[model samples]
Target: MAMAFQSILPTLPCFLPASNLPDGIDAPAVARGFATLGAWSLDDFTSDAMWRDSVALTGTLRTFYSAATVSAGWTERCFARQVHAFQLNPDAARVVRPAPGLGWINIPFTFATNTPTTTCSGFVSLVRGEGGWKIWLLRTILEQFDGYPNVDEPPQQPPVPIDGAEYECVIVGCGQSGLSVAGRLQALGVSYVVVDKVSQVGESWLQRYESMKLHTPRETSHLPFGRTFTDEYPEFLSRQDLARGYQAWAEKYSINILFSTELVSGSWNGDRRRWTLHLRQNGEVRSIACTHVVMAVGAGGHEPVRPHYLGEDIFQGDILHTAQYNNPHQWRGKRAIIIGCANSAHDVAEDMVEAGLASVTMVQRSRTCVIPVEYMPTRAADTITTADRNQYSAPLALNWQLSRLHIRAQIEANPARFDALERAGFRVDRSGDVFAHVHERYGGHYLDVGNCANIVKGLIQIKSTSPNHPIRFTPSGLLFSEGSNDSHLPADVIVFATGFKQNVRDTVRQLFGEDVYDAVDDYWGIDNEGEIRGAFKPSYHGNIWFLSGTSGHSRYFSRFIALLIKAGVEGVEVPVYRGVPGKAHEVEEVGGRGRGRGHKN
Candidate 1:
């Protein structure tokens, strides 16, 4: 009868350790039986049978004896002893199947070993052995084991589309001001689109001469939302770094940009209450409709102005403008002459000199201001705390006051601090000094002393004409007047650093028809012939606004304009300025609030 039971025992359902079972079984009664005994322990005799049944079952073994020790040979002896006891009895009878009335029946079993009688606590199942019930299977349930439930993860949401339908605003430039306006609009949760004629953001700077870098430090050059690279690189960012930083910022914020899209025309549709944009993109014409349009096309996007000089066409040697000066390698080892003494002219001259050019002559029609990248007090090594550094470096009126104090102290100690050429063997033509010359030209109305200082220090040479004779062009390589008897000086190259002209009114007129100028004039309350805020006044309609070309020239001024635009959009009180013609302009103390004016250039 026992032999009949043994043959059928292997077919009976036995509850082994829960760990031994396949996953996803929800049988609670079988699970409870596995939890009661330590069937998962390595000492359990039935563990070997369970491993034999499920070949996937594996356990980690630790050998305590070192390789050099004599006991290392006996390590396997201990393992063999355990294996022999398990093989002799196998403890296969302890595995059990639960009855309906009894919770769990523990049928004790003994290991069939000749060495000694070793008993282990386990459970046994009963099988119909031909005529009567007989012990069939045995297993020790692992009492302390627990099973974790599985959870299904939720699905992911799809991405939001770029250049989506129904844009609230459309800004037409990717330069500093355009970026600022786009960022502000984004912060307000307003849908907006930015379009640029160039293929990449900040290409305007990339197209400039190799020597060009930001005049302002990164702390002041940062756009809206406090996005800047100054925190990472304390030094001034080169042109390429600046361009890449702008591109990274646009990507980080996911700013919608339509590259290589030229704005052909845009008109205010009063009936639809939206502006219709006619643009040319990749040889295809597309029109977009938006409630507001911001024209931030900036001052330098159009073709450069090449003045019709008398001998310009006749000169056989290379003659390029500052805008076209890409690299100095072509002019290396040659006598390069750069015309005009503005920032570009100075920069080009320095670059040519550094690139192994034989001689770099700067032909100056007038002097230029060359201020240091940062004033001494604003430098990182100036020994100021981090909090005070930002405050002192800010573009606020109070910050300017601190800067002026520092400048005054330096200038008073040595007036020559403002004149570098005079110290470098070049005579200063001080008919009235640089400050007097500036006061005579623009009057006190718009003169910035720092700009005046830069102009004086950058003047390397002053052209002088002899009495009764036309100014001579010297053969010794110097620029002289047309009437001079001296021979024309030969130059390898000539570059013009004449400043940029801010002329967005013509562009606006061409796009929106003649009505835009009149509308803008009336909106700013400008008299028919009068200029507002040093240029054509800005006009704001609802949350939409336009900052004309004059405002785009200076970086400091553009930042102030951005702030005004933000305040206007947020329904905050507009800042007002009040001052007479000659004195420094002061903001009115109305409600103890005033808007900062753009920097005087």
Candidate 2:
């Protein structure tokens, strides 16, 4: 199916001076109009049959009204969480064109039942018709998190700290992925503890090379509930800055994190549907029990990949992988040869050259999709890819689809970025956009800041050859493949920027047992149900879960993971939601079908 979509921009009269709304849509007026309809929905929860009604709701309101009862427990306290979540600007309204004829804005609201502490969140779209606007579509988004159970401080039942800890949930890996999940779990009042192998929270970023800076912009990469960071960092932040921010986020939220902890083994309790994890802290073995266990360790750190060469023993010099690469301060006059052509390789080669290396060469083993940092605008998608779709308020799946369509267009529009590099024997791939390429093959791409410029300017040597080319070691340096023009390149240091073991299943197996590993070995790929296999969704294994991806993704989808875990803890029946209920339509154009990208680099 074509995954194309259009981002709607609304227009209202300019005479309205009371509010200055972006795209000229009277957001406050639209909000007030939906509030009136929200009250009316309580009683007149009726609409004409299906899509032919005076106001259409895409069947969400009909399905909600058909329910046997809507309220539960003590007094029904309702809360309105603005549906403009898709837009960063609070004053702007999220507009969408579900059908060619209908333009609706999502007005998300939630209601809570205090007794059992359950919440239901959804949205109502105010349709812009011939007579101003009227409430059209109403739907349920999520049951637990979006249900608005608390206001001042979120609803949370503090974890019970104890020796040989037993808890409802144990979140492993204290990186951003784990911290994001911990925040969501804490907000839901779920009893969960976060554990990591490092000594501090932001060690992951701090451990990277000193010169590393995020390729992504500051606003899009911001953590959930931390808008302050976006302002503090208007551009890409340094690794040290990111580390301090991570430590501060954990501190500000009172996140429960256990550092210097290693999981020796995890055994599944078939009868109880829980996990008994054996952990080692300070060289002492201890056991912790929990109903659910979330693995937050990503493919990047699970295992470093070191491809073998023919005669590595002949070379007597330092050859380090990018994983252990700290800085180039020592390799001042050394002849360094960086293997692999991905981002790390380019970055490392650039670092060597800038560090005043005698010579730096980057071997391009495969084709890669390289895009500049401008691909991600401060705002959302620029041109609408499909008329049937909307970017502001679509289901995440559909949004992913639309995003790919939009990004593909951006690449197609600009050919100058890759043309010269390709002419210079560089294999630039247009098989898909950078986003899809990353998900499909983690190997192909670098979001260039300076490396490409150096490659073009003859500052960095480029060798376009197969990754498995024969490499033999010589006493002085190394010999390249016989087929290549340059048979030898003297090098004192070789850094492998090759990828790591991305199999989440294998990584999980190493932490748990084979049985646990077997349960989720087929980790990444499209599943039978059409959902992305393994990460946020439940794996083949029960209770065991995965949390991996960029920080923004972790921030957004952590709620779903927390809700599922929360369901198990509270013993509440989770209602079936067919992909975040909304009016965003699927792309009708077949040509628009493509892959997508994540928020983080």
> How many residue pairs clash in all the candidates, one count each?
19, 6
lDDT of 2 by residue, 1-601 (tens): 0112111111101010111223667665667544443343323222220111000111111122111122100001122122222211223457654223334465655444333344544555554433445444344434443453332233344444545478888988988789878887787677778888899978888888778887776655545554526466648777887877888878877788889988878887666676789889999989989888888887444578877776787788788888899998798888887778777888788888789988887777767767776764344443221111222233333333444455566678888767878766677765335554443343446777778888777778877665435367776676766553547778888888887777677666677767676656354433322234566644434477687776555665566677667665766433222122121252111110001111110
Model 1 lDDT on a 0 to 1 scale: 0.42
TM-scores, all models, native as reference: 0.54, 0.72
**lDDT digits (tens) for residues 308-411 of candidate 1:** 34455555567777778887888787776665544466667667756877666555443333333343344343222222222322212222233444544554
Highest-lDDT candidate: 2
Q: Which stretches of candidate 2 lie over 4 Å from their true place?
A: 1-140, 143-164, 228-230, 379-401, 408-413, 466-468, 482-486, 528-530, 575-601
After superposing candidate 1 on the true structure, give the runs of residues whose Cα lies further than 4 Å from its correct spot. 1-166, 299-303, 374-405, 417-420, 423-479, 482-487, 521-544, 547-601
Decoy 1 TM-score against native: 0.54
Cα lDDT computed for each candidate against the true fold: 0.42, 0.57
